[model samples]
Target chain A: MIPNLTLAVVAGVLFATGVYLLLARSITRALLGIVLLSNGANVLLLVAAGPAGEAAFYGRTPESDMSDPLPQAMVLTAIVITLGMTAFILAMAHRSWQLSQTDIVADDVEDLRLVELAVRDVAPHDEERPDVDDDAAGDDRPPGPGTDAVVEP
Target chain B: MTGIDWDILVPLPVVLALAGAGVAVVVTGRIRLQRAVSVVTLSLVLVVALALLVGADREGPLSVTVGGWPARMGVVLIVDRLAALMLVVSATVTLGVLLYSIGQGAASTDEERADEQAPLPIFHPTMLVLSAGVSNTFITGDLFNLYVGFEILLASSFVLLTLGGSAPRIRAGISYVVVSLLASVILLSAIAMLYAATGTVNMAQMAERLDALPEGTRLVLQLMLLVAFAVKAAVFPMFGWLPDSYPTAPAPVTAVFAGLLTKVGVYSIMRTQTLLFPGDQLTELLMWAALATMLVGILGAVAQDDIKRMLSFTLVSHIGFMLFGVAVGTAAGISAAIFYVAHHITVQTTLFLVIGLIERYGGTTSLTRLGGLAKLAPVLAVLFFLPAMNLAGIPPFSGFLGKAGLLQAGAEQATWLAYLLIAGSVLTSLLTLYAIARVWSRAFWQPPIEPATEGLERVPRGMTLPAAALVAVGLAITVVAGPLFAVTDRAAADMLERAPYIDAVFPGGVP
Candidate 1:
């Protein structure tokens, strides 16, 4: 069976742009990337159905002339699954915005801490040293007498 | 063979869990009812899985075409020895984790509940759905069905991972979700290409047709499938999201994910490699990947101070051992890999659950802050100690047996790469021991930095019981190792021969 070059090219472009958007720091863009990527995959599935023919129906089309029904079934299943996931991710993005007022993905805190320790050239074993002047440690400390005294009580 | 109809049972595990999930959701906010539904559903699945295991071992592979469609035209669910064994082990662990989570929910104080989003009522349903997804992946005979199974599990896992919608979890969830989506897209595209080439999505049909394709096309398809599965399996370079995302979730959530999700990926890799692309075409590449996964994962584990992160790293490392067995591409190798998957699932989940207990008892997972835990909770110490040693490949344990099997398989292959992997496996084992030893010495042996905080409750029995049961189950695997090995050996032979699976799907031969 001959393949459809035009549809294949469209799928490739979709994948390329989807991956580019996926690399962004913003969660909303990442969600859009997933949408595009799944759409690209769906298009590829349609292309995999091969050259178009009459709609697959029991009595309407001869066996040899009917288009493949399997790929269309698979593409529909994929689309539904993607729709569900898109809704879930959208909910998560809203929740993230509510929590932090921004949906930009943040670096892992533990990973960042490890990076900071490496930058300071201090062994992880010595991380507990009181005199090390750790910024994270300072942040965890309760506010001093001059600031937030009423909030503490 | 027996009077019971085994073919009908192939889909029961998936069906039961999914139906139970629906019931669980309907009973939401009624915690006790929801819990009952989950427990009963999983327990039924376990029984069904056990029956399938026995029947498959005794009779042969059992399959049922969905909606009464012919094998070539419609979806099929088949349960051979490998799939049945996976179903049994997964059901067992899901039940164990479910009980532990229920215990944890009961024991948590109201203030603790308010702090972390109250262990949302949605947990039970999602967990059940995850189990269904895992079972579906194991039993599916259609490649596209396998993809659907993956999405089922992944969607549920996304919910489980970020149950509370807290800042840290959302942060972790975003990365986890996007990476998983990317993997899914890649897998879908690969399926499309395979369909375009082979004209069928049924795995048995594909297995037959793939051999007639051009060598380059076959190789490209194989590599694409491998890349997608490798990400899910957490092999070397693709594993960055795992250690970062897994530790932030609540304990039981992390435990189930650690136990089953990655193993699903490994299972798919084993299936596709042996069935559809049966040759030594990519064995060397797999060996190199296994070696890198082992060494890098263990080295990361050694550097971690948090027990959760350390165990997560170790989880990634042990996946290498399974991959090593797969790379060997011999009967002995695949058998050992299967055994290792079962052993690792139990030990890893037990370790995580015990760590949860530790966090509750000691008030922190940080080694620097935790001290004198042996004196405070000797039972918890024992629970933790046994699994840690097992994970580190202590003798007379299932872990040791599984590792020894892989080592022996590597020795039989005796390629230079196999030797390199054997050496890597031993070193990784030793480093694993060192990592566990460090945790023991620092957390239990050292004196308390300060007196235990007042009102710190004793580690609740409800939580401890399930963990101890899992530890016992791990030990039980060692007790039954001989028979288990025999079954896995037969399973491997069947997988490699390819006749049993293909003939089961198309008993009359391909049309």
Candidate 2:
């Protein structure tokens, strides 16, 4: 039987990679990060159930020697949930491509501006943009929505 | 040993919401019919919740063990004072938000073209599903069932958040979904660990088994559970997604999200801390988080010039107040936290709905563009004013009462951290007051910076009525704070002592 150590180590590797990628600037990499992270969590869930013993089906093995079925069931449910989430996120990433040119998760304009201010140690700048002011009671810079300075091609 | 009477009530709220969702989906083409179904389902849920509250209060905790499986093998639904009280409050808030959404939806359908209102048909069904998820989270006795409830809510919210199909909504939805999915994965893994550490997932059974575990192991499990929940609750250091995500959703979606979702996380923390890992082993950590969340959240609020972002930060800040009470580990503190959650849900949702009105009337939520609103829409001004002050913990409001009770509890403990939290709580409240005042002065008091290019539309009666109703309900909580606190105190007492809950489930001695 595979020991908990191997499982845990693999899980750790997956998690480390996932987190590293998650911190990446690209949305696709972040999506990949989510996939790896969820899979790692699933593996950990299995490890949490202890070393495998016997088949889950009744009469195939004595009940005492049977592997815990709850975690398996939980893992199944988690996998399904992760599937749905991944698909949804993929759609969002696709939409980002359609609407804008890039697949990077841009920070909202306010977030980007704050980062800009910190880096340059300069005062804020207000710039005009498309989209925010639609009607008559417009003209205020409603933060020009989200974009990252570093994310530009 | 299971009584069939309360057994039926345990699943009723969730069942009604889901069944209603099913019917609403079938009637989705007709927005009017869908609205009718949504209202009826939530209203029925509210009525059932009130009955559950009365039953639980009068008859101690009632439980239903699913499928008659032996003790640790099956799911259990518990209706205790704490669960019942949360059920009632959550149902009330969801129902109020549903009505408000209908109003907003109807208003938009009347004015906007096809593309804008395209998603309105599905909104009612999804809203029902969200309500079911919330109800399930509150009532379920087992941990995995609660996780299922969270998933239900998360899926529905993922849809609701991106309803408008606008760029910002999708961007914000991506953040929301990613954060929530991460939290769900962590929560599932933690449950697996908890089940492995103990031999069961039935909470009562696990509590008994976990008592025998090594101290270090118990602490590990406790921390895992806490971290998982902290992410959901938007506690400090884990709340990065909230302000970014919530402010971009449609108003009703944001209102409901602001009102209930994070509170469900807080509710779970309360439950687990009291049941499986009782006492103050994690109190020090929770206390620091409490202080940090309050201070950081309020400071975020102060820095925002947009109404939605400002309100979102205030929401984060106020969660700190509830966590503070939980950290205190005293009956008064826990009760006060519960009371504060109730007050915050109503006031937060009301403020968001009011902001929706302001956005509509002024054509923007940016404080820089908004002003002379008090002169234009006095009804809207009053609606915004009452809840804004209430949220800031103004006197004679439930917010003030809840904070006062929490501060009194912390002071009684007399710990240095508790004292620091006390000071933090007061400072946070004042800062919140200042933040709202910034909005008031810039948006309502000052004359409009520019002449109106178009006349402001009178807010639809439907919209104002629901917002006003919630504000009045908040006022009712203040006016009747005495009885409410008494109920809260009793609920808190029942929650802190695990014996009654366990005994009710197992009949005789705990398993």
Candidate 3:
């Protein structure tokens, strides 16, 4: 039989810890949390497959009594994918750190601010604006939306 | 799951071979050698892809298992008309981009000098890895394998998207990374839940089992999977990350991504919704999402001066057209969506490549910084006009044909959703026309200004030729619409009727 309350509690604790770290600002912590969460999910999947009384190593035959191996194989694949992604994320974090001198999102407000500036800079009306000649051609749609006005700051 | 034979899975090895070559090129690190290797590897993959397509076209659907394991036991790769067609399209676009990138040579950005020590020849390897991942995704028969394929592509794409290492690229790359990782997490969780519920990862088998599950549980699980794919496909609200981040990448990188990557997401959604859960309820949700995606994408497109950014938004918008077809839950609708996807893949890539050419020749991609390109480069003008107009769904073009097919299918569905699709499509087309017209008026038709001419430079033969070649292909598709439509129609038919696929995998029955 499965380890009942102990295994459930451990899986729950792992999931909670993972969720906490994943929400953190630090990329490294987030990566670590993904790993933990995946492991937790693996355990949960195993428990869902029914009782896990004994290790597969103890039982030579899977037909008689053994924890399912499919979930284990899936977990193995998940771990490999996680490792590859973690490496890529670390590289990205390093690059972000080098470029902006900070890995935190708040420090990279320049680009976000640029888009706002661009939106505001577009003049409300131009000769190309459809409303210039559409007084008699009153439309239900928003006025400027139809105009092929220039959109550069 | 029984009619499919177990012998048609040779494309996997071919895909891995190219991936291995890319790894070798990166490890070797000699720039000249890497370039040569990339060209050879890409061309080889293209040839193999073509062969696979032709072979499958003649012999029908095929499947092969890892080692000797059964479909439920080990990884399975299946090839049918749809998969073969996607492989060929992906390889062709990749081949073109590989040629263009190799000819363009080393990038000339200040960031390259600053970060020269970390990695060398970043683009070539990443592109190869991405190709392998795309190929794997298209061919794989299991859900978890598809997840792995997505991770492979996403991780490599993060590298390619930020290849230049500029401030904007890095910033955009960060958002792209976070959003993509979140999607992956959601997808993985869905896989976990599905596995827990069914104990199998094979898609065909799961399709059979999914019907037996309680409707509530299945609906929740399917919704999770749909949300994840939607994020990857950049549909409507999930699309915020696309236009900003896609425009930050180098042109060749962006072009290949536009051609293949998001379509893979669309492809997966199509597969799952059409084959596994053919219900009427999700179609309504998809219809609303399609309407929003079309309108929002075009609206964003209208508000952009940057050609790349505008095109990126339009990319988001056009996804709605495809989803509209798939959302109808009719044979006609799925067929049209398939046709639309194939057409959009080639047409969009050609447009992006042309835009890159425009940026190179005209000095900037922004309308404010560009003017009088037609006077200086008439050939480039023709190149840009064809795909741009086609993308806007002008008549006598493949884009128009595909859009008409989708519209026809939408009408045939004859529901409130159908009317919504029809209206949304017309609006999206008009906005698309306006966006392309804006680019044309500013970048091509307008008279030259003094400062702009001073910055204007001759387009390099390296860049111009690829753009020219792509324009030719785009035009050929338009001119030969009848034949192309037949191919797309057949591919669509094969996809909608999943028996060929299920049969190829099972060979007897799925029992």
- Measured by DockQ, the strongest candidate is 1
Instruction: Estimate the TM-score for candidate 2.
Output: 0.93
**Chain A accuracy as TM-score for every candidate:** 0.76, 0.73, 0.59
Total backbone collisions for each predicted model: 0, 0, 5
Q: What is candidate 1's CA lDDT for residue B275?
A: 97
Residues B221-263 of candidate 2 have per-residue lDDT tens digits of: 9998899899999999999899999998878788999999999
**Residue pairs with clashing backbones, model 1:** none
lDDT of candidates 1 onward, in order: 0.91, 0.85, 0.77
> What's model 2's lDDT at B413?
96
lDDT by residue for model 3 (B142-225), tens: 898899889878887988888757777777777788778778877877887788777788987887788899999989888989
What stretches of model 3 exceed 4 Å from their correct place? A1-41, A57-59, A106-153, B1-9, B13-29, B106-119, B450-452
Worst 10 residues of 3 chain B by lDDT: B1-10
User: What lDDT, from 0 to 1, does candidate 2 have?
Assistant: 0.85
Tell me the spans in candidate 2 whose CA falls farther than 4 Å from its real position. Answer: A1-3, A115-153, B1-3, B109-120
Q: A107-129 in candidate 3: lDDT tens per residue?
A: 23334445445444433443457
- Give the TM-score comparing model 1 with the true structure, all chains together: 0.94
- After TM-score superposition, the amount by which residue B510's alpha carbon in candidate 1 deviates from its true location, in angstroms, is 1.1
| CAPRI rating of model 1 | medium
User: Compared with the true structure, what per-residue lDDT tens digits does model 2 show for residues A41-114?
Assistant: 88988888888888878977899899888888878888898898889888888887888777777676467657
